[model samples]
Target: MATSTEHLIDIDRYTGELIQGWERIKQSIFVILTTRLRTRLMRLWWGSKFNEMQDKPGNEEVLMSSMMAAISAINTYEPEFKVTRVVIEDMGPDGEITITVEGIDLVDEALRRLKTTI
Candidate 1:
């Protein structure tokens, strides 16, 4: 397994210290999924367009498109994480969506999963 020394965006809750490795990768995935594309001026191409699917009909086509956008964004922006699959579940009538990302951690060569609601 490779080593990571990068500091976490937020300090660890119990330890009050920086996180690294897989936890950092999870944090990165969360940021990429939630950030809207082109919103960050410097990193215009850094985020996924998946958020655009919000409020739209959650048909197969839209879900597929969102999935592709998410994979593309992660592939383009973060190289350490290799996405294996992305699953999006539409919560009916609640306007909430859950996204699950499964991938390999290039740094450690281990499978990793991240789930978030948007």
Candidate 2:
């Protein structure tokens, strides 16, 4: 298996420890999902359009759109993580949504899961 290393963004909290392999890939996925598209000056194409779904009615159409946006973002940004499945749940009244992403870590050859709320 191959290894990829990245400096943890929160160096102060981590005490300068480096994130490697699967963990690094997982972190990258979260970053890509949370970021708004075109927000980054240099990397204008980076990030997911999932955030646009916010404030919209959480109907089936919106949910499916959100899921597709997530898959597209991960597929484009994190080539090392091959997404196998994406699950989105509407968390009721508050309009909160939870996204679960499952994929294969190409570098580690292991299954990995990431869950985040949007």
The number of clashing residue pairs in each candidate reads 0, 0
lDDT string for model 2 (10-103, tens) is: 2222456766566677678878887898999999988999888877887889888988998989988886788889998554566566889998
Residue-by-residue lDDT tens digits, candidate 1, 21-117: 7776777777887899789999886788877888788888888898998898787767678899999865456667798899888776779888888
State in Å the error of residue 73, model 1: 0.8
In order, what lDDT does every prediction score? Answer: 0.78, 0.77
Q: How much lDDT does candidate 2 score?
A: 0.77
Clashing pairs in 2: none
Q: In model 1, how large is the Cα lDDT of residue 78? A: 70
Q: What shift in Å separates residue 70 of candidate 1 from its native position after superposition? A: 0.9
